[model samples]
Target: MASVTSAESGRLGTLPLGYYSCSEPGDAGGQAWIDLPDKHFTIGNGSTYHTDAGSGTYLLTGKRVIFTRGPMKGVRFERSGKVTLRWIDEDGKPGRVRCVRQASSV
Candidate 1:
Protein backbone atom coordinates (compact mmCIF):
# COMPACT_ATOMS: atom_id res chain seq x y z
CA MET A 1 0.00 0.00 0.00
CA ALA A 2 1.22 3.47 -0.77
CA SER A 3 1.08 6.31 1.71
CA VAL A 4 -0.14 9.80 0.89
CA THR A 5 1.12 12.92 2.60
CA SER A 6 -1.02 15.92 3.50
CA ALA A 7 0.36 17.96 0.64
CA GLU A 8 -0.21 15.12 -1.76
CA SER A 9 -3.74 14.52 -0.58
CA GLY A 10 -4.71 18.16 -1.19
CA ARG A 11 -3.65 17.87 -4.77
CA LEU A 12 -5.37 14.55 -5.45
CA GLY A 13 -8.86 16.01 -5.85
CA THR A 14 -10.73 19.20 -6.73
CA LEU A 15 -12.75 19.84 -3.55
CA PRO A 16 -11.88 23.31 -2.30
CA LEU A 17 -11.51 24.17 1.37
CA GLY A 18 -14.46 26.24 2.55
CA TYR A 19 -18.04 26.21 3.78
CA TYR A 20 -20.71 24.43 1.79
CA SER A 21 -24.47 24.67 1.83
CA CYS A 22 -26.21 21.35 1.50
CA SER A 23 -29.81 20.75 0.64
CA GLU A 24 -31.81 17.57 0.75
CA PRO A 25 -35.34 16.24 1.03
CA GLY A 26 -36.85 16.31 4.54
CA ASP A 27 -34.23 18.64 5.93
CA ALA A 28 -35.45 21.76 7.68
CA GLY A 29 -35.88 24.31 4.93
CA GLY A 30 -33.89 21.76 2.97
CA GLN A 31 -30.54 23.08 4.18
CA ALA A 32 -27.46 22.02 6.09
CA TRP A 33 -23.81 23.01 6.09
CA ILE A 34 -20.37 21.48 5.90
CA ASP A 35 -16.88 22.83 6.33
CA LEU A 36 -13.69 21.55 4.79
CA PRO A 37 -10.60 22.95 6.43
CA ASP A 38 -7.39 21.41 5.33
CA LYS A 39 -7.52 17.82 6.59
CA HIS A 40 -10.51 18.33 8.86
CA PHE A 41 -14.13 17.97 7.81
CA THR A 42 -17.20 19.18 9.71
CA ILE A 43 -20.92 18.87 9.11
CA GLY A 44 -23.73 20.66 10.88
CA ASN A 45 -27.09 22.30 10.58
CA GLY A 46 -27.50 26.00 9.86
CA SER A 47 -24.14 27.67 10.59
CA THR A 48 -23.07 25.54 13.50
CA TYR A 49 -20.23 23.92 11.66
CA HIS A 50 -17.80 26.09 13.54
CA THR A 51 -19.00 24.75 16.89
CA ASP A 52 -19.84 21.19 15.94
CA ALA A 53 -17.72 18.53 17.51
CA GLY A 54 -18.76 15.73 15.22
CA SER A 55 -16.05 16.55 12.71
CA GLY A 56 -13.94 13.85 11.15
CA THR A 57 -11.40 13.21 8.46
CA TYR A 58 -12.15 12.90 4.78
CA LEU A 59 -10.54 11.34 1.76
CA LEU A 60 -10.84 12.70 -1.77
CA THR A 61 -10.07 10.59 -4.81
CA GLY A 62 -10.74 11.56 -8.37
CA LYS A 63 -14.21 13.07 -8.24
CA ARG A 64 -15.35 11.25 -5.09
CA VAL A 65 -15.14 12.10 -1.45
CA ILE A 66 -15.54 9.73 1.47
CA PHE A 67 -15.94 10.57 5.15
CA THR A 68 -13.37 8.24 6.54
CA ARG A 69 -13.85 8.92 10.27
CA GLY A 70 -16.17 10.54 12.80
CA PRO A 71 -19.96 10.73 12.95
CA MET A 72 -20.25 10.96 9.21
CA LYS A 73 -18.04 7.99 8.57
CA GLY A 74 -18.81 5.88 5.52
CA VAL A 75 -20.71 8.64 3.77
CA ARG A 76 -19.69 9.16 0.17
CA PHE A 77 -20.20 12.03 -2.26
CA GLU A 78 -19.39 12.56 -5.90
CA ARG A 79 -18.57 15.82 -7.58
CA SER A 80 -21.34 16.97 -9.86
CA GLY A 81 -19.96 20.35 -10.89
CA LYS A 82 -17.24 22.87 -10.22
CA VAL A 83 -18.44 23.36 -6.67
CA THR A 84 -21.19 20.82 -6.22
CA LEU A 85 -21.22 17.42 -4.60
CA ARG A 86 -24.04 14.92 -4.58
CA TRP A 87 -24.47 12.23 -2.03
CA ILE A 88 -24.01 8.65 -3.14
CA ASP A 89 -26.64 6.34 -1.77
CA GLU A 90 -26.07 2.74 -0.79
CA ASP A 91 -27.27 1.73 -4.21
CA GLY A 92 -24.47 3.85 -5.72
CA LYS A 93 -26.90 6.31 -7.21
CA PRO A 94 -26.93 10.04 -6.60
CA GLY A 95 -29.16 10.77 -3.63
CA ARG A 96 -31.32 13.78 -2.89
CA VAL A 97 -28.64 15.59 -0.94
CA ARG A 98 -26.69 18.15 -2.91
CA CYS A 99 -23.97 20.44 -1.58
CA VAL A 100 -22.49 23.54 -3.13
CA ARG A 101 -19.60 25.64 -2.08
CA GLN A 102 -20.85 28.70 -0.20
CA ALA A 103 -17.58 30.38 0.73
CA SER A 104 -13.88 29.90 0.32
CA SER A 105 -11.34 29.86 3.10
CA VAL A 106 -7.60 30.02 3.41
Candidate 2:
Protein backbone atom coordinates (compact mmCIF):
# COMPACT_ATOMS: atom_id res chain seq x y z
CA MET A 1 0.00 0.00 0.00
CA ALA A 2 1.01 3.63 -0.50
CA SER A 3 1.52 5.74 2.51
CA VAL A 4 -0.03 9.17 2.15
CA THR A 5 0.73 12.27 4.12
CA SER A 6 -0.85 15.67 4.21
CA ALA A 7 0.07 18.41 1.74
CA GLU A 8 3.52 18.80 3.22
CA SER A 9 5.79 17.05 0.67
CA GLY A 10 7.88 15.36 3.29
CA ARG A 11 10.16 12.43 2.48
CA LEU A 12 7.98 9.34 2.41
CA GLY A 13 9.62 6.34 0.76
CA THR A 14 12.78 4.73 -0.62
CA LEU A 15 13.76 4.88 -4.25
CA PRO A 16 16.14 1.97 -4.68
CA LEU A 17 16.32 2.27 -8.47
CA GLY A 18 16.70 5.59 -10.28
CA TYR A 19 16.18 6.10 -13.99
CA TYR A 20 16.75 8.93 -16.53
CA SER A 21 17.19 9.35 -20.26
CA CYS A 22 17.83 11.57 -23.33
CA SER A 23 15.01 11.66 -25.82
CA GLU A 24 13.74 13.67 -28.79
CA PRO A 25 10.39 15.38 -29.27
CA GLY A 26 8.82 12.87 -26.90
CA ASP A 27 9.98 11.93 -23.45
CA ALA A 28 9.29 8.82 -21.39
CA GLY A 29 9.87 7.69 -17.82
CA GLY A 30 13.64 7.27 -18.36
CA GLN A 31 14.44 10.00 -20.86
CA ALA A 32 15.58 13.62 -21.06
CA TRP A 33 16.17 16.52 -23.42
CA ILE A 34 19.45 18.21 -24.20
CA ASP A 35 20.50 21.01 -26.55
CA LEU A 36 23.72 19.19 -27.25
CA PRO A 37 23.82 15.89 -29.13
CA ASP A 38 24.46 12.31 -27.98
CA LYS A 39 24.39 13.03 -24.30
CA HIS A 40 22.83 10.93 -21.55
CA PHE A 41 21.35 12.00 -18.23
CA THR A 42 20.89 10.08 -15.02
CA ILE A 43 17.49 9.81 -13.33
CA GLY A 44 18.00 10.01 -9.63
CA ASN A 45 15.33 10.17 -6.97
CA GLY A 46 14.38 13.71 -5.94
CA SER A 47 15.74 15.06 -9.23
CA THR A 48 13.36 17.40 -11.02
CA TYR A 49 13.63 18.30 -14.69
CA HIS A 50 12.98 21.85 -15.88
CA THR A 51 10.31 20.30 -18.04
CA ASP A 52 7.22 19.13 -16.30
CA ALA A 53 7.89 15.98 -18.27
CA GLY A 54 10.76 15.36 -15.92
CA SER A 55 9.63 13.04 -13.15
CA GLY A 56 11.36 10.68 -10.71
CA THR A 57 10.23 7.47 -9.09
CA TYR A 58 11.83 7.28 -5.68
CA LEU A 59 11.60 3.97 -3.90
CA LEU A 60 9.29 4.24 -0.92
CA THR A 61 9.79 2.09 2.11
CA GLY A 62 7.24 2.47 4.94
CA LYS A 63 6.57 6.17 4.85
CA ARG A 64 3.82 8.20 3.22
CA VAL A 65 3.83 11.05 0.66
CA ILE A 66 2.57 14.59 1.05
CA PHE A 67 2.18 16.61 -2.13
CA THR A 68 3.19 20.14 -1.31
CA ARG A 69 3.28 21.44 -4.88
CA GLY A 70 1.50 21.30 -8.21
CA PRO A 71 -2.04 22.08 -9.37
CA MET A 72 -3.07 18.50 -9.86
CA LYS A 73 -1.91 15.08 -8.63
CA GLY A 74 -3.62 11.82 -9.55
CA VAL A 75 -2.98 9.20 -6.89
CA ARG A 76 -5.13 6.11 -6.75
CA PHE A 77 -5.91 3.18 -4.44
CA GLU A 78 -6.77 -0.24 -5.77
CA ARG A 79 -7.53 -3.82 -4.83
CA SER A 80 -4.23 -5.09 -6.30
CA GLY A 81 -2.42 -2.69 -3.98
CA LYS A 82 -0.86 -0.58 -6.69
CA VAL A 83 -0.37 3.01 -7.80
CA THR A 84 0.01 4.56 -11.23
CA LEU A 85 1.80 7.84 -11.69
CA ARG A 86 1.79 10.38 -14.49
CA TRP A 87 4.58 12.88 -14.75
CA ILE A 88 5.94 15.24 -17.35
CA ASP A 89 9.08 13.93 -18.99
CA GLU A 90 12.20 15.98 -19.62
CA ASP A 91 11.09 16.15 -23.23
CA GLY A 92 7.66 17.30 -22.05
CA LYS A 93 5.87 14.05 -22.84
CA PRO A 94 3.44 12.62 -20.35
CA GLY A 95 4.94 9.59 -18.67
CA ARG A 96 3.18 6.85 -16.80
CA VAL A 97 4.54 5.27 -13.62
CA ARG A 98 3.25 2.24 -11.80
CA CYS A 99 3.99 1.03 -8.28
CA VAL A 100 2.87 -2.24 -6.77
CA ARG A 101 3.18 -3.94 -3.42
CA GLN A 102 1.54 -6.71 -1.42
CA ALA A 103 0.45 -4.38 1.38
CA SER A 104 0.79 -0.77 2.38
CA SER A 105 1.62 0.79 5.67
CA VAL A 106 -0.88 0.50 8.50
Candidate 3:
Protein backbone atom coordinates (compact mmCIF):
# COMPACT_ATOMS: atom_id res chain seq x y z
CA MET A 1 0.00 0.00 0.00
CA ALA A 2 1.10 3.55 -0.61
CA SER A 3 0.10 6.89 0.75
CA VAL A 4 -1.60 9.10 -1.80
CA THR A 5 0.82 11.95 -1.20
CA SER A 6 3.93 9.87 -2.01
CA ALA A 7 2.60 6.93 -3.95
CA GLU A 8 5.50 6.86 -6.34
CA SER A 9 7.88 6.30 -3.48
CA GLY A 10 5.99 3.21 -2.42
CA ARG A 11 4.30 0.47 -4.42
CA LEU A 12 3.92 2.47 -7.61
CA GLY A 13 7.63 3.29 -7.72
CA THR A 14 8.94 6.11 -9.92
CA LEU A 15 6.84 7.46 -12.77
CA PRO A 16 8.43 7.92 -16.16
CA LEU A 17 9.75 11.47 -16.18
CA GLY A 18 9.11 13.33 -19.45
CA TYR A 19 6.31 14.18 -21.84
CA TYR A 20 3.14 12.30 -22.78
CA SER A 21 0.88 13.16 -25.71
CA CYS A 22 -2.61 12.00 -26.53
CA SER A 23 -3.12 11.62 -30.25
CA GLU A 24 -5.63 8.78 -30.49
CA PRO A 25 -8.69 10.34 -28.89
CA GLY A 26 -8.66 13.53 -30.91
CA ASP A 27 -7.29 16.94 -29.81
CA ALA A 28 -9.13 17.59 -26.58
CA GLY A 29 -6.83 15.50 -24.42
CA GLY A 30 -3.70 17.40 -25.39
CA GLN A 31 -0.26 16.68 -23.93
CA ALA A 32 1.59 16.93 -20.66
CA TRP A 33 5.14 16.99 -19.39
CA ILE A 34 5.60 15.25 -16.06
CA ASP A 35 8.59 15.75 -13.79
CA LEU A 36 8.66 13.15 -11.06
CA PRO A 37 10.25 13.40 -7.64
CA ASP A 38 9.14 16.99 -7.84
CA LYS A 39 5.53 16.04 -8.78
CA HIS A 40 5.21 19.00 -11.11
CA PHE A 41 3.41 18.78 -14.45
CA THR A 42 2.47 20.99 -17.37
CA ILE A 43 -0.30 20.65 -19.91
CA GLY A 44 -0.61 22.15 -23.38
CA ASN A 45 -2.59 21.91 -26.55
CA GLY A 46 -1.42 20.51 -29.90
CA SER A 47 -1.08 23.83 -31.72
CA THR A 48 1.18 25.15 -28.98
CA TYR A 49 3.61 22.24 -29.32
CA HIS A 50 3.07 21.62 -25.60
CA THR A 51 4.99 24.78 -24.73
CA ASP A 52 2.56 25.60 -21.92
CA ALA A 53 -1.09 25.55 -21.02
CA GLY A 54 -1.41 24.88 -17.32
CA SER A 55 0.78 23.68 -14.46
CA GLY A 56 -0.03 21.42 -11.51
CA THR A 57 0.99 18.87 -8.94
CA TYR A 58 0.04 15.22 -9.17
CA LEU A 59 -0.09 12.05 -7.11
CA LEU A 60 -0.19 8.36 -7.90
CA THR A 61 -2.61 5.84 -6.43
CA GLY A 62 -2.04 2.26 -7.45
CA LYS A 63 -2.13 2.39 -11.24
CA ARG A 64 -3.72 5.80 -11.47
CA VAL A 65 -2.29 9.29 -11.34
CA ILE A 66 -4.45 12.14 -10.10
CA PHE A 67 -3.81 15.74 -11.02
CA THR A 68 -4.19 17.69 -7.80
CA ARG A 69 -3.84 21.30 -8.87
CA GLY A 70 -4.21 23.76 -11.69
CA PRO A 71 -6.83 23.59 -14.43
CA MET A 72 -6.35 19.88 -14.74
CA LYS A 73 -7.16 19.25 -11.17
CA GLY A 74 -9.22 16.08 -10.63
CA VAL A 75 -8.03 14.62 -13.93
CA ARG A 76 -7.24 10.94 -13.61
CA PHE A 77 -5.03 8.60 -15.60
CA GLU A 78 -4.17 4.96 -15.37
CA ARG A 79 -0.80 3.52 -16.34
CA SER A 80 -0.89 1.26 -19.35
CA GLY A 81 2.86 0.69 -19.43
CA LYS A 82 6.08 1.98 -18.02
CA VAL A 83 5.80 4.98 -20.28
CA THR A 84 2.19 4.99 -21.30
CA LEU A 85 -0.99 6.14 -19.62
CA ARG A 86 -4.67 6.25 -20.51
CA TRP A 87 -6.40 9.43 -19.53
CA ILE A 88 -9.95 9.09 -18.27
CA ASP A 89 -11.85 11.98 -19.77
CA GLU A 90 -15.30 13.11 -18.67
CA ASP A 91 -17.11 11.67 -15.74
CA GLY A 92 -18.97 8.43 -16.50
CA LYS A 93 -17.75 8.52 -20.10
CA PRO A 94 -16.35 5.30 -21.47
CA GLY A 95 -13.36 6.35 -23.54
CA ARG A 96 -9.76 7.12 -22.78
CA VAL A 97 -7.10 9.19 -24.45
CA ARG A 98 -4.00 7.15 -25.08
CA CYS A 99 -1.06 9.21 -23.97
CA VAL A 100 2.31 7.91 -25.08
CA ARG A 101 5.50 8.87 -23.42
CA GLN A 102 8.18 10.62 -25.42
CA ALA A 103 11.85 11.17 -24.83
CA SER A 104 12.61 14.00 -22.47
CA SER A 105 14.40 15.79 -25.28
CA VAL A 106 11.11 16.44 -26.99
Candidate 4:
Protein backbone atom coordinates (compact mmCIF):
# COMPACT_ATOMS: atom_id res chain seq x y z
CA MET A 1 0.00 0.00 0.00
CA ALA A 2 1.11 3.58 -0.70
CA SER A 3 1.14 6.36 1.81
CA VAL A 4 -1.92 8.62 1.51
CA THR A 5 -0.65 12.17 1.62
CA SER A 6 -2.60 15.37 2.01
CA ALA A 7 -3.81 16.69 -1.33
CA GLU A 8 -3.80 20.21 0.12
CA SER A 9 -3.05 22.25 3.18
CA GLY A 10 -5.71 23.25 5.75
CA ARG A 11 -8.02 20.50 4.53
CA LEU A 12 -8.94 19.05 7.87
CA GLY A 13 -11.32 16.71 9.73
CA THR A 14 -10.72 13.48 7.85
CA LEU A 15 -12.90 10.44 8.73
CA PRO A 16 -13.63 6.84 7.74
CA LEU A 17 -16.75 6.17 5.57
CA GLY A 18 -19.13 4.80 8.23
CA TYR A 19 -18.16 7.72 10.47
CA TYR A 20 -21.14 9.57 8.93
CA SER A 21 -22.66 7.90 5.85
CA CYS A 22 -24.80 4.73 5.61
CA SER A 23 -24.57 3.37 2.05
CA GLU A 24 -27.46 0.92 2.65
CA PRO A 25 -29.76 3.78 3.72
CA GLY A 26 -31.97 3.81 6.92
CA ASP A 27 -28.84 3.36 9.02
CA ALA A 28 -27.96 6.94 8.08
CA GLY A 29 -28.47 9.05 11.17
CA GLY A 30 -28.19 12.87 11.15
CA GLN A 31 -24.46 12.33 11.50
CA ALA A 32 -24.48 14.31 8.25
CA TRP A 33 -22.96 16.95 10.45
CA ILE A 34 -19.73 15.55 9.04
CA ASP A 35 -20.10 18.04 6.19
CA LEU A 36 -21.16 21.00 8.28
CA PRO A 37 -19.67 24.51 8.67
CA ASP A 38 -18.54 25.03 5.11
CA LYS A 39 -18.04 28.21 3.12
CA HIS A 40 -20.41 29.22 0.29
CA PHE A 41 -20.43 27.29 -3.03
CA THR A 42 -22.24 25.10 -5.63
CA ILE A 43 -21.54 21.73 -7.33
CA GLY A 44 -21.16 20.17 -10.78
CA ASN A 45 -23.34 17.12 -11.22
CA GLY A 46 -21.61 16.44 -14.52
CA SER A 47 -18.56 15.19 -12.63
CA THR A 48 -20.13 13.18 -9.86
CA TYR A 49 -19.00 9.54 -9.77
CA HIS A 50 -19.56 6.39 -7.65
CA THR A 51 -16.93 3.73 -8.10
CA ASP A 52 -16.41 0.62 -5.96
CA ALA A 53 -12.88 0.44 -4.50
CA GLY A 54 -13.55 -2.50 -2.15
CA SER A 55 -13.05 -0.46 1.01
CA GLY A 56 -16.24 1.53 0.41
CA THR A 57 -18.06 3.49 -2.28
CA TYR A 58 -17.51 7.22 -1.61
CA LEU A 59 -20.32 9.67 -2.37
CA LEU A 60 -19.25 13.14 -3.56
CA THR A 61 -22.76 14.65 -3.18
CA GLY A 62 -21.90 17.88 -5.05
CA LYS A 63 -20.11 20.12 -2.56
CA ARG A 64 -17.03 20.87 -0.48
CA VAL A 65 -16.01 17.65 1.30
CA ILE A 66 -13.79 16.16 3.98
CA PHE A 67 -13.19 12.45 3.55
CA THR A 68 -11.57 9.53 5.35
CA ARG A 69 -10.33 6.71 3.18
CA GLY A 70 -8.97 3.21 3.73
CA PRO A 71 -5.34 2.49 4.51
CA MET A 72 -4.70 1.40 0.94
CA LYS A 73 -4.02 3.01 -2.45
CA GLY A 74 -5.43 2.89 -6.02
CA VAL A 75 -8.88 3.40 -4.56
CA ARG A 76 -12.04 4.81 -6.20
CA PHE A 77 -14.80 7.29 -5.13
CA GLU A 78 -18.48 8.03 -5.73
CA ARG A 79 -20.32 11.32 -6.16
CA SER A 80 -23.40 11.84 -4.00
CA GLY A 81 -23.39 15.65 -3.67
CA LYS A 82 -26.52 15.69 -5.95
CA VAL A 83 -25.78 18.99 -7.73
CA THR A 84 -24.88 19.33 -11.41
CA LEU A 85 -21.74 17.14 -11.58
CA ARG A 86 -19.36 19.81 -12.83
CA TRP A 87 -16.01 19.05 -11.22
CA ILE A 88 -13.64 21.96 -11.08
CA ASP A 89 -9.90 21.36 -11.50
CA GLU A 90 -9.51 20.03 -7.99
CA ASP A 91 -6.71 21.95 -6.33
CA GLY A 92 -7.10 19.57 -3.46
CA LYS A 93 -6.23 15.90 -3.82
CA PRO A 94 -9.11 13.99 -5.46
CA GLY A 95 -9.83 12.20 -2.20
CA ARG A 96 -13.14 12.38 -0.30
CA VAL A 97 -15.09 15.64 0.02
CA ARG A 98 -18.40 16.77 1.58
CA CYS A 99 -20.64 19.60 0.47
CA VAL A 100 -22.03 22.34 2.62
CA ARG A 101 -25.79 23.06 2.83
CA GLN A 102 -25.79 25.89 0.26
CA ALA A 103 -26.95 23.50 -2.46
CA SER A 104 -23.43 23.40 -3.81
CA SER A 105 -20.90 20.66 -4.52
CA VAL A 106 -17.62 21.24 -2.83
On lDDT, the leading prediction is 1
Best by TM-score: 1
The alpha-carbon RMSD values of the candidates against the true structure, listed in the order shown, are: 8.6, 12.2, 9.7, 14.8
How many clashes show up per model? 0, 15, 0, 31
Superposed on all Cα atoms, model 3 deviates from the true structure by an RMSD in Å of: 9.7
State model 2's lDDT. 0.31
Task: Please say which candidate is ahead in lDDT: 2 or 4.
Answer: 2
Write the residue-wise lDDT of candidate 1 on 5-105 in tens digits.
Answer: 45335445446667666666454564354333432333333212331446666667767777777666777888777878888999978887777777777
Give a tens-digit lDDT track for model 4, residues 1-106.
9764443222332212211221211226655334322221222233222223323222332233322333212222333353212222245344334322332223
TM-score of each: 0.61, 0.22, 0.57, 0.19
User: Which ten residues in a row are the worst by lDDT in model 3?
Assistant: 42-51
Q: Which stretches in model 4 have alpha-carbon errors above 4 Å? A: 1-50, 57-62, 71-81, 88-106
Better of 2 and 4 by TM-score: 2
Model 3 per-residue lDDT tens digits across residues 1-106: 9453443344533456566655443344653433332222333332112225556666665677667676567767777778777767677232445666666543
- Best-to-worst TM-score order: 1, 3, 2, 4
List candidate 3 segments past 4 Å from native: 1-14, 25-51, 92-94
Residue 46's lDDT within candidate 4 is 34
